[model samples]
Target: MDLPVGHIVTVLEEMGIFEDDSEPPFEHWLVGRLEGLAPGIRSEAERWTRVLRDGGPRSLPRREGTVWLSLNQVCLALLEWSNRYDHLREVTRDDVLAHVKTLHGHQRRDQPVALRSLFTWAKRQGVIFRNLTSRIKVGQNEYAVLQPLLPEQVERSVAAALTPAARLVLAAVRAARVAQIAVLVLDDVDLGNRRLIIAGRARPLDDLTLKLLADRLPTGDAGGRAPRTSTTPTRPAVPATTGSARRCKDRTPPLERLRVDRQLEETLTHGPDPLHLAEVFGLDEKTAMRYADSARALLEQDAESGFSRDTRQGGNE
Candidate 1:
Protein backbone atom coordinates (compact mmCIF):
# COMPACT_ATOMS: atom_id res chain seq x y z
CA MET A 1 0.00 0.00 0.00
CA ASP A 2 1.72 3.20 1.30
CA LEU A 3 4.84 3.63 3.43
CA PRO A 4 6.44 6.50 5.35
CA VAL A 5 9.11 8.26 3.19
CA GLY A 6 11.71 7.68 5.91
CA HIS A 7 11.24 3.90 5.94
CA ILE A 8 11.34 3.65 2.14
CA VAL A 9 14.47 5.77 1.96
CA THR A 10 16.06 3.54 4.61
CA VAL A 11 15.20 0.37 2.69
CA LEU A 12 16.51 1.77 -0.60
CA GLU A 13 19.73 2.97 1.10
CA GLU A 14 20.33 -0.46 2.63
CA MET A 15 20.00 -2.01 -0.83
CA GLY A 16 22.52 0.53 -2.28
CA ILE A 17 19.92 1.53 -4.90
CA PHE A 18 19.08 4.98 -3.53
CA GLU A 19 21.17 6.30 -6.43
CA ASP A 20 20.61 4.90 -9.99
CA ASP A 21 24.39 4.62 -10.47
CA SER A 22 24.38 2.56 -7.28
CA GLU A 23 21.51 0.38 -8.63
CA PRO A 24 22.24 -3.27 -9.48
CA PRO A 25 21.81 -4.86 -12.93
CA PHE A 26 18.92 -6.64 -14.75
CA GLU A 27 18.03 -8.82 -11.74
CA HIS A 28 17.34 -5.66 -9.72
CA TRP A 29 15.07 -4.31 -12.51
CA LEU A 30 13.30 -7.69 -12.74
CA VAL A 31 12.63 -7.83 -8.98
CA GLY A 32 11.19 -4.31 -8.99
CA ARG A 33 9.13 -4.92 -12.17
CA LEU A 34 7.82 -8.25 -10.83
CA GLU A 35 6.97 -7.03 -7.28
CA GLY A 36 5.68 -3.46 -7.57
CA LEU A 37 7.19 -1.41 -4.71
CA ALA A 38 5.27 0.98 -2.46
CA PRO A 39 4.62 4.57 -3.58
CA GLY A 40 7.44 6.01 -1.40
CA ILE A 41 9.92 3.45 -2.80
CA ARG A 42 8.83 4.18 -6.36
CA SER A 43 9.09 7.91 -5.75
CA GLU A 44 12.66 7.51 -4.43
CA ALA A 45 13.51 5.25 -7.40
CA GLU A 46 12.31 7.98 -9.78
CA ARG A 47 14.47 10.53 -7.94
CA TRP A 48 17.54 8.24 -8.12
CA THR A 49 16.94 7.72 -11.86
CA ARG A 50 16.92 11.49 -12.47
CA VAL A 51 20.08 11.95 -10.36
CA LEU A 52 21.93 9.24 -12.31
CA ARG A 53 20.74 10.68 -15.67
CA ASP A 54 21.85 14.21 -14.76
CA GLY A 55 24.98 12.91 -12.96
CA GLY A 56 26.66 15.91 -11.26
CA PRO A 57 26.35 15.20 -7.54
CA ARG A 58 22.68 16.21 -7.51
CA SER A 59 22.86 16.90 -3.79
CA LEU A 60 25.60 17.49 -1.31
CA PRO A 61 25.63 15.01 1.57
CA ARG A 62 24.59 16.38 4.93
CA ARG A 63 27.48 17.33 7.21
CA GLU A 64 27.50 16.89 10.99
CA GLY A 65 28.37 19.97 13.01
CA THR A 66 29.42 20.03 16.67
CA VAL A 67 26.17 21.85 17.70
CA TRP A 68 23.88 19.48 19.57
CA LEU A 69 20.60 19.63 21.52
CA SER A 70 19.43 17.35 24.24
CA LEU A 71 18.11 14.19 22.57
CA ASN A 72 15.16 14.17 24.98
CA GLN A 73 13.83 17.67 24.18
CA VAL A 74 14.24 17.22 20.41
CA CYS A 75 12.21 14.00 20.41
CA LEU A 76 9.51 15.62 22.47
CA ALA A 77 9.21 18.59 20.09
CA LEU A 78 9.12 16.32 17.02
CA LEU A 79 6.49 13.99 18.45
CA GLU A 80 4.30 16.85 19.63
CA TRP A 81 4.51 18.75 16.32
CA SER A 82 3.87 15.68 14.12
CA ASN A 83 1.00 14.47 16.27
CA ARG A 84 -0.72 17.86 16.18
CA TYR A 85 -0.47 18.50 12.40
CA ASP A 86 -0.71 15.00 10.89
CA HIS A 87 -4.11 15.59 9.27
CA LEU A 88 -3.13 19.05 8.00
CA ARG A 89 -0.53 19.54 5.28
CA GLU A 90 1.38 22.15 7.33
CA VAL A 91 1.98 23.07 10.97
CA THR A 92 0.30 26.22 12.36
CA ARG A 93 0.79 28.45 15.42
CA ASP A 94 -1.35 26.19 17.54
CA ASP A 95 0.95 23.34 16.49
CA VAL A 96 3.98 25.31 17.65
CA LEU A 97 2.44 26.38 20.96
CA ALA A 98 1.39 22.78 21.56
CA HIS A 99 4.92 21.57 20.82
CA VAL A 100 6.46 24.33 22.99
CA LYS A 101 4.14 23.40 25.86
CA THR A 102 5.32 19.81 25.65
CA LEU A 103 8.95 20.89 25.40
CA HIS A 104 8.54 23.17 28.41
CA GLY A 105 6.81 20.41 30.41
CA HIS A 106 6.44 21.72 33.98
CA GLN A 107 8.54 24.75 32.97
CA ARG A 108 5.24 26.38 31.79
CA ARG A 109 5.02 27.85 35.32
CA ASP A 110 8.34 29.50 34.39
CA GLN A 111 8.26 30.90 30.79
CA PRO A 112 10.37 28.68 28.57
CA VAL A 113 13.39 30.33 26.95
CA ALA A 114 14.36 27.07 25.27
CA LEU A 115 11.30 27.32 22.97
CA ARG A 116 13.18 29.49 20.45
CA SER A 117 16.27 27.32 20.67
CA LEU A 118 14.26 24.18 20.05
CA PHE A 119 12.46 25.67 17.01
CA THR A 120 15.81 26.85 15.60
CA TRP A 121 17.21 23.37 16.14
CA ALA A 122 14.25 21.75 14.35
CA LYS A 123 14.55 24.19 11.43
CA ARG A 124 18.24 23.32 11.10
CA GLN A 125 17.40 19.63 11.16
CA GLY A 126 14.85 20.15 8.30
CA VAL A 127 12.34 17.99 10.16
CA ILE A 128 9.55 20.46 11.04
CA PHE A 129 8.16 22.37 8.05
CA ARG A 130 9.13 26.05 7.72
CA ASN A 131 6.93 29.04 6.61
CA LEU A 132 3.97 27.42 8.35
CA THR A 133 2.17 30.49 9.68
CA SER A 134 4.91 32.01 11.86
CA ARG A 135 2.15 33.61 13.91
CA ILE A 136 -1.00 32.23 15.52
CA LYS A 137 -3.57 33.75 17.79
CA VAL A 138 -5.76 32.05 20.39
CA GLY A 139 -8.68 33.84 22.07
CA GLN A 140 -7.50 37.46 22.48
CA ASN A 141 -3.84 36.57 22.98
CA GLU A 142 -1.42 36.30 20.06
CA TYR A 143 1.92 34.46 19.99
CA ALA A 144 4.64 34.31 17.39
CA VAL A 145 5.28 30.89 15.90
CA LEU A 146 8.99 31.48 16.33
CA GLN A 147 9.95 34.72 18.01
CA PRO A 148 13.56 35.83 17.50
CA LEU A 149 15.68 37.82 19.94
CA LEU A 150 14.40 41.39 20.53
CA PRO A 151 16.63 44.47 20.22
CA GLU A 152 16.90 44.84 24.00
CA GLN A 153 17.66 41.13 24.33
CA VAL A 154 20.47 41.37 21.78
CA GLU A 155 21.88 44.46 23.50
CA ARG A 156 21.71 42.80 26.91
CA SER A 157 23.40 39.64 25.61
CA VAL A 158 26.15 41.62 23.91
CA ALA A 159 26.63 43.84 26.95
CA ALA A 160 26.87 40.85 29.31
CA ALA A 161 29.50 39.36 27.01
CA LEU A 162 31.58 42.54 26.70
CA THR A 163 32.85 45.35 28.95
CA PRO A 164 31.41 48.91 28.97
CA ALA A 165 34.32 50.27 26.88
CA ALA A 166 34.18 47.23 24.63
CA ARG A 167 30.46 47.91 24.14
CA LEU A 168 31.35 51.36 22.78
CA VAL A 169 33.92 49.90 20.38
CA LEU A 170 31.50 47.20 19.21
CA ALA A 171 28.71 49.75 18.51
CA ALA A 172 30.94 51.67 16.08
CA VAL A 173 31.92 48.50 14.23
CA ARG A 174 28.27 47.47 13.83
CA ALA A 175 27.29 51.00 12.84
CA ALA A 176 29.79 50.88 9.99
CA ARG A 177 28.35 47.59 8.68
CA VAL A 178 24.74 48.78 8.76
CA ALA A 179 25.65 52.01 6.87
CA GLN A 180 24.68 54.05 9.92
CA ILE A 181 28.21 55.46 9.95
CA ALA A 182 30.59 55.74 6.99
CA VAL A 183 33.85 54.68 8.61
CA LEU A 184 35.18 54.25 12.14
CA VAL A 185 38.74 55.53 12.38
CA LEU A 186 41.29 56.66 14.96
CA ASP A 187 40.57 60.30 14.12
CA ASP A 188 37.69 62.73 14.81
CA VAL A 189 34.19 61.74 13.58
CA ASP A 190 32.98 63.60 10.46
CA LEU A 191 29.41 64.47 11.52
CA GLY A 192 28.22 67.30 9.21
CA ASN A 193 30.29 65.87 6.34
CA ARG A 194 29.45 62.18 7.24
CA ARG A 195 32.61 60.20 6.37
CA LEU A 196 35.70 58.58 7.88
CA ILE A 197 38.82 56.77 6.55
CA ILE A 198 39.78 53.87 8.80
CA ALA A 199 42.64 51.35 8.26
CA GLY A 200 41.99 50.89 4.49
CA ARG A 201 38.30 50.15 3.74
CA ALA A 202 35.70 52.91 3.31
CA ARG A 203 31.86 52.71 3.47
CA PRO A 204 28.86 55.01 3.63
CA LEU A 205 26.33 54.62 6.48
CA ASP A 206 23.90 57.48 7.14
CA ASP A 207 23.27 56.98 10.83
CA LEU A 208 23.47 59.87 13.33
CA THR A 209 24.30 57.38 16.12
CA LEU A 210 27.30 55.98 14.20
CA LYS A 211 28.44 59.54 13.39
CA LEU A 212 28.51 60.16 17.16
CA LEU A 213 30.24 56.83 18.03
CA ALA A 214 32.94 57.61 15.52
CA ASP A 215 33.54 60.83 17.46
CA ARG A 216 34.09 58.84 20.66
CA LEU A 217 36.82 56.61 19.15
CA PRO A 218 40.12 57.17 21.00
CA THR A 219 42.74 59.21 19.21
CA GLY A 220 46.55 59.73 19.42
CA ASP A 221 49.35 57.84 21.29
CA ALA A 222 49.74 60.52 24.01
CA GLY A 223 47.73 58.55 26.62
CA GLY A 224 50.45 55.78 26.72
CA ARG A 225 47.95 52.97 26.07
CA ALA A 226 48.06 50.72 23.00
CA PRO A 227 45.38 51.54 20.38
CA ARG A 228 42.56 49.01 20.47
CA THR A 229 40.44 48.13 17.44
CA SER A 230 36.66 47.60 17.35
CA THR A 231 35.86 43.84 17.44
CA THR A 232 32.23 43.72 16.15
CA PRO A 233 32.45 45.14 12.64
CA THR A 234 29.38 43.42 11.18
CA ARG A 235 26.55 43.42 13.72
CA PRO A 236 23.17 44.97 12.95
CA ALA A 237 22.39 48.36 14.55
CA VAL A 238 18.74 48.73 15.56
CA PRO A 239 17.05 51.97 14.52
CA ALA A 240 16.98 54.02 17.71
CA THR A 241 16.85 57.83 17.41
CA THR A 242 15.16 58.52 14.06
CA GLY A 243 12.71 55.63 14.46
CA SER A 244 10.42 57.68 16.70
CA ALA A 245 10.45 60.63 14.30
CA ARG A 246 9.67 58.43 11.30
CA ARG A 247 6.91 56.67 13.21
CA CYS A 248 5.55 60.04 14.31
CA LYS A 249 5.42 61.34 10.75
CA ASP A 250 3.92 58.16 9.27
CA ARG A 251 1.26 57.59 11.95
CA THR A 252 -2.36 58.32 10.86
CA PRO A 253 -3.78 60.36 13.78
CA PRO A 254 -0.34 61.80 14.72
CA LEU A 255 -1.16 61.33 18.42
CA GLU A 256 1.67 58.76 18.58
CA ARG A 257 4.00 61.39 17.13
CA LEU A 258 2.89 63.98 19.70
CA ARG A 259 3.38 61.45 22.49
CA VAL A 260 6.90 60.66 21.24
CA ASP A 261 7.63 64.39 20.96
CA ARG A 262 6.34 64.98 24.50
CA GLN A 263 8.53 62.16 25.81
CA LEU A 264 11.49 63.81 24.08
CA GLU A 265 10.63 67.11 25.83
CA GLU A 266 10.46 65.41 29.23
CA THR A 267 13.85 63.72 28.67
CA LEU A 268 15.39 67.08 27.83
CA THR A 269 13.69 68.85 30.75
CA HIS A 270 14.94 66.25 33.24
CA GLY A 271 17.06 63.28 32.19
CA PRO A 272 20.49 61.66 32.59
CA ASP A 273 23.70 63.16 31.12
CA PRO A 274 24.64 62.84 27.45
CA LEU A 275 27.31 60.15 28.02
CA HIS A 276 24.82 57.94 29.87
CA LEU A 277 22.16 58.53 27.18
CA ALA A 278 24.68 57.53 24.51
CA GLU A 279 25.40 54.25 26.32
CA VAL A 280 21.72 53.55 26.95
CA PHE A 281 20.77 54.24 23.35
CA GLY A 282 23.86 52.44 21.95
CA LEU A 283 24.94 55.74 20.43
CA ASP A 284 28.27 57.52 20.61
CA GLU A 285 28.65 60.40 23.09
CA LYS A 286 29.07 62.91 20.27
CA THR A 287 25.68 61.95 18.79
CA ALA A 288 24.22 61.92 22.30
CA MET A 289 25.58 65.44 22.85
CA ARG A 290 24.04 66.51 19.55
CA TYR A 291 20.65 65.17 20.70
CA ALA A 292 21.17 66.96 24.05
CA ASP A 293 21.96 70.14 22.16
CA SER A 294 18.79 69.75 20.09
CA ALA A 295 16.79 69.11 23.28
CA ARG A 296 18.22 72.19 24.98
CA ALA A 297 17.46 74.23 21.89
CA LEU A 298 13.86 72.99 21.90
CA LEU A 299 13.54 73.89 25.58
CA GLU A 300 14.83 77.41 24.81
CA GLN A 301 12.23 77.78 22.04
CA ASP A 302 9.50 76.56 24.41
CA ALA A 303 10.52 79.06 27.11
CA GLU A 304 10.85 81.93 24.60
CA SER A 305 7.26 81.32 23.33
CA GLY A 306 6.01 80.58 26.89
CA PHE A 307 4.85 77.25 25.47
CA SER A 308 6.85 75.38 28.12
CA ARG A 309 5.07 76.87 31.15
CA ASP A 310 1.77 77.40 29.30
CA THR A 311 1.60 73.75 28.25
CA ARG A 312 2.36 72.74 31.84
CA GLN A 313 -0.45 75.06 33.05
CA GLY A 314 -2.96 73.35 30.69
CA GLY A 315 -2.82 76.11 28.05
CA ASN A 316 -4.52 78.65 30.39
CA GLU A 317 -4.67 82.32 29.41
Candidate 2:
Protein backbone atom coordinates (compact mmCIF):
# COMPACT_ATOMS: atom_id res chain seq x y z
CA MET A 1 0.00 0.00 0.00
CA ASP A 2 1.19 3.53 -0.84
CA LEU A 3 1.41 5.41 2.44
CA PRO A 4 1.49 9.21 2.70
CA VAL A 5 4.56 11.09 4.04
CA GLY A 6 2.65 12.01 7.24
CA HIS A 7 1.81 8.34 7.83
CA ILE A 8 5.44 7.32 7.25
CA VAL A 9 6.65 10.03 9.63
CA THR A 10 4.10 8.89 12.24
CA VAL A 11 5.22 5.28 11.82
CA LEU A 12 8.86 6.32 12.27
CA GLU A 13 7.99 8.35 15.37
CA GLU A 14 6.02 5.43 16.83
CA MET A 15 9.03 3.15 16.21
CA GLY A 16 11.11 5.49 18.49
CA ILE A 17 13.33 6.63 15.58
CA PHE A 18 12.17 10.22 16.32
CA GLU A 19 11.88 11.86 19.76
CA ASP A 20 8.43 12.03 21.36
CA ASP A 21 8.65 15.79 22.04
CA SER A 22 8.57 17.14 18.47
CA GLU A 23 8.28 16.07 14.81
CA PRO A 24 11.51 15.10 13.04
CA PRO A 25 13.10 17.90 11.01
CA PHE A 26 12.98 17.53 7.19
CA GLU A 27 16.84 17.54 7.09
CA HIS A 28 16.90 14.29 9.14
CA TRP A 29 14.93 12.38 6.48
CA LEU A 30 16.89 14.06 3.68
CA VAL A 31 20.26 13.17 5.34
CA GLY A 32 19.24 9.50 5.65
CA ARG A 33 18.09 9.45 1.99
CA LEU A 34 21.39 10.93 0.76
CA GLU A 35 23.48 8.17 2.45
CA GLY A 36 23.81 6.33 -0.90
CA LEU A 37 25.70 9.24 -2.49
CA ALA A 38 29.50 9.68 -2.28
CA PRO A 39 30.70 11.02 1.10
CA GLY A 40 31.59 14.49 -0.27
CA ILE A 41 28.30 14.82 -2.21
CA ARG A 42 26.26 13.43 0.73
CA SER A 43 27.84 16.01 3.08
CA GLU A 44 27.10 18.79 0.55
CA ALA A 45 23.49 17.59 0.13
CA GLU A 46 23.02 17.48 3.93
CA ARG A 47 24.28 21.07 4.27
CA TRP A 48 21.92 22.22 1.49
CA THR A 49 19.04 20.29 3.13
CA ARG A 50 19.82 22.01 6.45
CA VAL A 51 19.89 25.37 4.66
CA LEU A 52 16.36 24.68 3.35
CA ARG A 53 15.13 23.62 6.81
CA ASP A 54 16.56 26.71 8.52
CA GLY A 55 14.46 28.98 6.23
CA GLY A 56 16.24 31.89 4.56
CA PRO A 57 15.67 34.08 1.48
CA ARG A 58 16.31 31.02 -0.74
CA SER A 59 13.87 28.81 1.19
CA LEU A 60 10.08 28.99 0.86
CA PRO A 61 7.61 27.85 3.53
CA ARG A 62 6.57 24.81 1.50
CA ARG A 63 5.22 21.54 2.87
CA GLU A 64 7.79 18.94 4.06
CA GLY A 65 6.86 16.52 1.23
CA THR A 66 7.30 19.22 -1.45
CA VAL A 67 10.64 20.31 0.04
CA TRP A 68 11.82 16.71 0.25
CA LEU A 69 10.88 16.04 -3.40
CA SER A 70 12.50 19.26 -4.64
CA LEU A 71 15.69 18.65 -2.63
CA ASN A 72 16.00 15.08 -3.96
CA GLN A 73 15.44 16.19 -7.56
CA VAL A 74 18.05 18.98 -7.30
CA CYS A 75 20.58 16.65 -5.64
CA LEU A 76 20.04 13.96 -8.30
CA ALA A 77 20.45 16.50 -11.09
CA LEU A 78 23.67 17.84 -9.52
CA LEU A 79 24.95 14.31 -8.93
CA GLU A 80 24.41 13.41 -12.60
CA TRP A 81 26.16 16.58 -13.76
CA SER A 82 29.07 16.30 -11.29
CA ASN A 83 29.98 12.70 -12.28
CA ARG A 84 33.05 13.83 -14.33
CA TYR A 85 34.23 16.46 -11.79
CA ASP A 86 36.61 15.43 -9.01
CA HIS A 87 34.96 17.83 -6.53
CA LEU A 88 32.07 20.38 -6.37
CA ARG A 89 34.65 23.22 -6.37
CA GLU A 90 36.02 21.97 -9.75
CA VAL A 91 32.57 22.51 -11.37
CA THR A 92 32.97 25.69 -13.46
CA ARG A 93 30.50 28.33 -14.71
CA ASP A 94 30.37 26.73 -18.18
CA ASP A 95 29.49 23.38 -16.57
CA VAL A 96 26.63 25.01 -14.62
CA LEU A 97 25.38 26.82 -17.77
CA ALA A 98 25.56 23.54 -19.80
CA HIS A 99 23.57 21.67 -17.10
CA VAL A 100 20.95 24.47 -16.98
CA LYS A 101 20.57 24.33 -20.78
CA THR A 102 19.62 20.63 -20.56
CA LEU A 103 16.44 21.50 -18.59
CA HIS A 104 13.18 22.90 -20.06
CA GLY A 105 10.20 25.04 -18.99
CA HIS A 106 9.95 25.77 -15.23
CA GLN A 107 12.77 23.35 -14.52
CA ARG A 108 15.05 25.48 -16.70
CA ARG A 109 14.04 28.56 -14.72
CA ASP A 110 13.87 26.98 -11.20
CA GLN A 111 17.04 24.85 -11.26
CA PRO A 112 19.27 27.93 -11.73
CA VAL A 113 17.63 29.62 -8.75
CA ALA A 114 18.32 26.54 -6.61
CA LEU A 115 21.89 26.37 -7.91
CA ARG A 116 22.52 30.03 -7.15
CA SER A 117 21.15 29.61 -3.63
CA LEU A 118 23.18 26.46 -2.98
CA PHE A 119 26.42 27.94 -4.31
CA THR A 120 25.91 31.25 -2.48
CA TRP A 121 25.31 29.41 0.80
CA ALA A 122 28.32 27.14 0.20
CA LYS A 123 30.58 30.14 -0.51
CA ARG A 124 29.38 31.89 2.69
CA GLN A 125 30.16 28.74 4.69
CA GLY A 126 33.61 28.51 2.99
CA VAL A 127 32.62 25.09 1.58
CA ILE A 128 33.41 26.33 -1.96
CA PHE A 129 36.12 28.82 -2.94
CA ARG A 130 33.79 30.62 -5.41
CA ASN A 131 30.08 30.84 -6.27
CA LEU A 132 29.88 29.32 -9.77
CA THR A 133 26.29 30.46 -10.37
CA SER A 134 26.83 34.14 -9.40
CA ARG A 135 26.90 35.46 -12.98
CA ILE A 136 24.52 32.84 -14.46
CA LYS A 137 21.34 34.64 -15.45
CA VAL A 138 18.04 32.87 -16.11
CA GLY A 139 15.32 34.87 -17.85
CA GLN A 140 11.81 34.96 -16.39
CA ASN A 141 9.34 32.50 -17.85
CA GLU A 142 7.12 33.88 -20.65
CA TYR A 143 3.41 33.31 -20.07
CA ALA A 144 0.93 32.82 -22.97
CA VAL A 145 -1.19 35.92 -23.66
CA LEU A 146 -4.79 35.53 -22.49
CA GLN A 147 -7.20 36.11 -25.38
CA PRO A 148 -10.17 38.34 -24.51
CA LEU A 149 -13.70 37.41 -25.66
CA LEU A 150 -14.49 39.05 -29.01
CA PRO A 151 -17.41 41.55 -29.27
CA GLU A 152 -19.62 39.05 -31.15
CA GLN A 153 -18.76 36.28 -28.65
CA VAL A 154 -19.65 38.52 -25.72
CA GLU A 155 -22.97 39.45 -27.38
CA ARG A 156 -23.76 35.75 -28.07
CA SER A 157 -22.94 34.84 -24.43
CA VAL A 158 -25.16 37.66 -23.11
CA ALA A 159 -28.02 36.72 -25.47
CA ALA A 160 -27.71 33.03 -24.50
CA ALA A 161 -27.89 33.73 -20.72
CA LEU A 162 -31.45 32.38 -20.20
CA THR A 163 -31.61 31.95 -16.39
CA PRO A 164 -31.65 34.70 -13.75
CA ALA A 165 -28.46 33.26 -12.12
CA ALA A 166 -26.72 33.09 -15.54
CA ARG A 167 -27.62 36.69 -16.27
CA LEU A 168 -26.46 37.76 -12.79
CA VAL A 169 -23.09 36.02 -13.30
CA LEU A 170 -22.65 37.69 -16.72
CA ALA A 171 -23.48 41.07 -15.17
CA ALA A 172 -21.36 40.67 -12.01
CA VAL A 173 -18.27 39.48 -13.96
CA ARG A 174 -18.25 42.89 -15.68
CA ALA A 175 -17.06 44.50 -12.44
CA ALA A 176 -16.26 41.70 -9.96
CA ARG A 177 -14.28 38.45 -9.90
CA VAL A 178 -16.20 35.14 -9.88
CA ALA A 179 -14.97 34.50 -6.31
CA GLN A 180 -16.55 37.79 -5.12
CA ILE A 181 -19.77 37.05 -7.02
CA ALA A 182 -19.99 33.52 -5.54
CA VAL A 183 -20.18 34.86 -1.98
CA LEU A 184 -22.66 37.65 -2.76
CA VAL A 185 -25.80 37.86 -0.55
CA LEU A 186 -28.94 39.99 -0.90
CA ASP A 187 -27.35 42.41 1.64
CA ASP A 188 -24.59 43.20 -0.91
CA VAL A 189 -27.14 44.43 -3.45
CA ASP A 190 -28.84 47.86 -3.13
CA LEU A 191 -31.64 47.77 -5.72
CA GLY A 192 -33.13 51.09 -4.47
CA ASN A 193 -29.70 52.77 -4.85
CA ARG A 194 -28.86 50.79 -8.06
CA ARG A 195 -25.44 49.62 -6.78
CA LEU A 196 -23.58 46.45 -5.69
CA ILE A 197 -21.04 46.12 -2.83
CA ILE A 198 -18.39 43.84 -4.42
CA ALA A 199 -15.25 42.97 -2.41
CA GLY A 200 -15.94 45.87 -0.06
CA ARG A 201 -16.31 48.42 -2.90
CA ALA A 202 -19.54 49.97 -4.23
CA ARG A 203 -19.94 49.37 -8.00
CA PRO A 204 -22.71 51.02 -10.04
CA LEU A 205 -25.45 48.62 -11.17
CA ASP A 206 -26.93 48.88 -14.66
CA ASP A 207 -30.73 48.65 -15.15
CA LEU A 208 -30.41 45.20 -16.78
CA THR A 209 -28.17 43.96 -13.94
CA LEU A 210 -30.63 45.37 -11.35
CA LYS A 211 -33.47 43.50 -13.09
CA LEU A 212 -31.49 40.22 -13.12
CA LEU A 213 -30.78 40.52 -9.35
CA ALA A 214 -34.42 41.36 -8.63
CA ASP A 215 -35.52 38.25 -10.53
CA ARG A 216 -33.11 36.01 -8.54
CA LEU A 217 -33.70 37.52 -5.06
CA PRO A 218 -36.70 36.81 -2.84
CA THR A 219 -39.40 39.48 -2.72
CA GLY A 220 -38.71 42.51 -0.46
CA ASP A 221 -40.29 42.81 3.01
CA ALA A 222 -42.82 45.55 4.00
CA GLY A 223 -39.83 47.89 4.59
CA GLY A 224 -38.63 47.13 0.98
CA ARG A 225 -35.54 45.17 2.11
CA ALA A 226 -34.49 41.88 0.46
CA PRO A 227 -34.46 38.67 2.56
CA ARG A 228 -31.15 37.86 4.31
CA THR A 229 -30.68 34.64 2.27
CA SER A 230 -27.82 34.32 -0.29
CA THR A 231 -28.21 35.46 -3.91
CA THR A 232 -28.07 31.84 -5.13
CA PRO A 233 -28.87 28.57 -3.31
CA THR A 234 -25.23 27.59 -3.97
CA ARG A 235 -23.98 30.85 -2.47
CA PRO A 236 -20.24 30.01 -2.53
CA ALA A 237 -19.99 28.19 -5.90
CA VAL A 238 -20.11 30.17 -9.16
CA PRO A 239 -19.70 26.95 -11.24
CA ALA A 240 -23.47 26.28 -11.26
CA THR A 241 -24.11 29.72 -12.76
CA THR A 242 -21.27 29.24 -15.28
CA GLY A 243 -22.61 25.72 -16.02
CA SER A 244 -26.02 27.24 -16.74
CA ALA A 245 -24.42 29.75 -19.14
CA ARG A 246 -22.65 26.87 -20.99
CA ARG A 247 -25.97 24.99 -21.54
CA CYS A 248 -26.50 26.99 -24.75
CA LYS A 249 -25.57 25.44 -28.15
CA ASP A 250 -22.98 28.15 -28.91
CA ARG A 251 -19.62 27.95 -27.11
CA THR A 252 -19.81 30.40 -24.24
CA PRO A 253 -16.61 32.07 -22.99
CA PRO A 254 -15.63 31.41 -19.37
CA LEU A 255 -16.42 34.04 -16.72
CA GLU A 256 -12.71 34.96 -16.48
CA ARG A 257 -12.59 35.69 -20.25
CA LEU A 258 -15.68 37.87 -19.88
CA ARG A 259 -13.97 39.77 -17.05
CA VAL A 260 -10.84 40.27 -19.24
CA ASP A 261 -13.01 41.45 -22.13
CA ARG A 262 -14.68 43.94 -19.77
CA GLN A 263 -11.30 45.25 -18.60
CA LEU A 264 -10.07 45.57 -22.22
CA GLU A 265 -13.24 47.45 -23.18
CA GLU A 266 -12.75 49.81 -20.25
CA THR A 267 -9.09 50.34 -21.28
CA LEU A 268 -10.07 51.11 -24.89
CA THR A 269 -12.80 53.53 -23.78
CA HIS A 270 -10.55 55.34 -21.24
CA GLY A 271 -7.41 55.44 -23.47
CA PRO A 272 -5.37 52.63 -21.78
CA ASP A 273 -4.29 54.48 -18.62
CA PRO A 274 -2.82 51.92 -16.18
CA LEU A 275 -3.65 54.06 -13.12
CA HIS A 276 -7.27 54.42 -14.23
CA LEU A 277 -7.51 50.66 -14.98
CA ALA A 278 -5.95 49.86 -11.60
CA GLU A 279 -8.44 52.05 -9.69
CA VAL A 280 -11.52 50.98 -11.71
CA PHE A 281 -10.76 47.23 -11.86
CA GLY A 282 -8.91 46.91 -8.48
CA LEU A 283 -5.91 45.52 -10.38
CA ASP A 284 -2.29 45.79 -9.26
CA GLU A 285 0.00 48.24 -11.14
CA LYS A 286 1.74 45.38 -13.01
CA THR A 287 -1.54 43.71 -14.06
CA ALA A 288 -3.07 47.06 -15.06
CA MET A 289 0.03 47.85 -17.19
CA ARG A 290 -0.28 44.45 -18.94
CA TYR A 291 -3.93 45.20 -19.81
CA ALA A 292 -2.96 48.69 -20.99
CA ASP A 293 -0.20 47.21 -23.19
CA SER A 294 -2.62 44.71 -24.71
CA ALA A 295 -5.13 47.49 -25.43
CA ARG A 296 -2.42 49.63 -27.08
CA ALA A 297 -1.37 46.66 -29.27
CA LEU A 298 -5.00 46.15 -30.32
CA LEU A 299 -5.37 49.87 -31.20
CA GLU A 300 -2.11 49.83 -33.22
CA GLN A 301 -3.34 46.75 -35.16
CA ASP A 302 -6.65 48.50 -35.92
CA ALA A 303 -4.81 51.63 -37.16
CA GLU A 304 -2.54 49.50 -39.40
CA SER A 305 -5.54 47.69 -40.84
CA GLY A 306 -7.39 50.99 -41.53
CA PHE A 307 -4.29 52.50 -43.16
CA SER A 308 -3.90 49.41 -45.42
CA ARG A 309 -7.59 49.67 -46.46
CA ASP A 310 -7.20 53.40 -47.34
CA THR A 311 -3.98 52.74 -49.33
CA ARG A 312 -5.72 49.91 -51.29
CA GLN A 313 -8.70 52.25 -52.09
CA GLY A 314 -6.36 55.06 -53.21
CA GLY A 315 -4.47 52.62 -55.52
CA ASN A 316 -7.81 51.39 -56.99
CA GLU A 317 -8.87 55.02 -57.77
TM-score winner among the candidates? 2
Maximum-lDDT candidate = 2
Per-candidate TM vs. native?
A: 0.21, 0.55
lDDT of 1 at 217: 45
The collision pairs in model 1 are 179-205, 180-207
For 1-317, candidate 1 gives per-residue lDDT tens digits of: 67667778899999988964556453364344423334433333333333333333333322122111222223344344444343222546666576445433334422233334334433444545663424432222222221112234333433342333433333343333323322333333333344433334332323423433444444424442214455343322222323323333333323232222322333454552576444433446655665566566656766788765334322110
lDDT of 2 by residue, 115-199 (tens): 7777887887788998988877775766454345545676677777777667777777766876677677666766767667777
Q: Can you tell me which runs of candidate 1 are displaced by over 4 Å?
A: 1-74, 79-192, 195-317
